[model samples]
Target: MANNQNAELLDKARLLRHDIRDGSFTGYTSGLVPGLVQGNVVILPKVWAEDFLLYCYLNPVSCPLISMSKPGDAMVPALGADIDIRTDIPQYNVFKDGELVEQVTDIEQYWSDDMVSFVLGCSFSFEEALLRAGLSIRNIDLDRNVSMFETNIATAPSAKFFGNTVVTMRPFKPADAIRAIQITTRLPKAHGAPIHIGMPNKIGIEDLAKPEYGDSVPVNDDEIPVFWACGVTPQVAIRNAKPPLCITHVPGKMLVTDKLNDELAVL
Candidate 1:
């Protein structure tokens, strides 16, 4: 029975990837594909890939490395059998000289022999675990992207890759927030634990409603905002690194992989 359920989930993920590839589903993938691992993407030239690799190593909590592709190789079979880094993601941000130049559904035009793609562990990979723990995820419940912000907290730098950490926020009552912390701690590959519990201002986020990326959700008066180190941190790094060319998934629209969330959990 468990095997049959897993097969069904895998089929769902493949279908979703097909829709993304065909430009049929160009939106955030937060609540969709429960139990499957989702990823954050960064595609760059071979010259810049090494530095970015070092950067991810330095900031493992914020930029946990998952599967990476060979230069000019658009396929990341380790993440999913049919993933084409250039087209499988719903949306992509094209950057030139550290500035965002365009947002597109497919990056086939930018493909080159020197381009390397990196897939990083996303917090969404652990949201299923949170749900299993009976935690109500506000963004998912509201059918919105998770709220993300650029914080004052700086990430450990490597070469030219340096920037403040970006984080995802979800508000919860105090007790539930504690439970969330415990539940998420078991998934270090998916950004293990909360970096900050409350007081958004303390982390340089002035307004919870005005996040730097993704959409904002309501926080009730009784709930406190909980912040987790986000996979989007690499975007800020890309801006600072000034790579001549870089391609990344738009903040909330992620690469849905066939890997199960439980496969990444620690005991």
Candidate 2:
């Protein structure tokens, strides 16, 4: 029975990846494919890969490294079977010299032998745990993208990579917010626990309605906004590092993997 269930989940992942690859599902991956692991992607030339890797090492909460591919290798078997970095994600953000050049559905044309791919754990991996704990996630409940913002918090610098942290926000009542902290604390790879519970302005976020990335969800009067260190922090660093070329998953859109979210939990 367990084997059947695993097979079913793997099938779901493959189907979703298929839709993403073919451009049928070009939207945020927040609430879809529950129970699977999703990732934020970063592709950089070999020359800049080491610095970015070190950056991830310096800031584990915001950029938890999951699986990295060999230079020129587009496949990440550790994350999922036959997972091709070039075409699996829903959307790609092309950056050239610290600026966003374009957004595309795939990176096949830009992919090359000198490039390396890195997959970082995403908070979407933990939303299932929150739901199971009987908590309501406003963004997920509304089928909208989670709100993300650039914060006043500075990340540890490494080589050319240095920037303020980016974070994702979810609204919950004070009591449910505490339970969310307890639930997510077990999944560090998925950015465990809340970094800040309220006061968006305290974190350099002036207005909750206006976000740096992803869609903004409504915050209820009785609820406070809970923030989690986001995987998209690398994109901010990529801008500061000013690499000649870089590729990342579009904010809110992610690379879905066959690995189960349960695998990332600790205790």
How many residue pairs clash in all the candidates, one count each? 0, 0
Provide the TM-score for each candidate, comma-separated. Answer: 0.98, 0.98
Give every collision pair in model 2.
none
Which 10 consecutive residues of model 2 have the lowest summed lDDT? Answer: 28-37
TM-score of 1: 0.98
Candidate 1 RMSD computed on C-alpha atoms after optimal superposition onto the true structure: 0.8
The whole-model lDDT of each prediction reads 0.93, 0.93
lDDT of 1 at 35: 95
Q: Report how far residue 203 has shifted in candidate 1, in Å.
A: 0.7
Q: Which stretches of candidate 1 lie over 4 Å from their true place?
A: none
- Using alpha carbons, what is the TM-score of model 2? 0.98
Tens digits of per-residue lDDT for model 2 on 70-116? 99999999998779999999999999998999999999999999999
Model 1 clashing residue pairs (backbone): none
lDDT of 2 at 183: 96
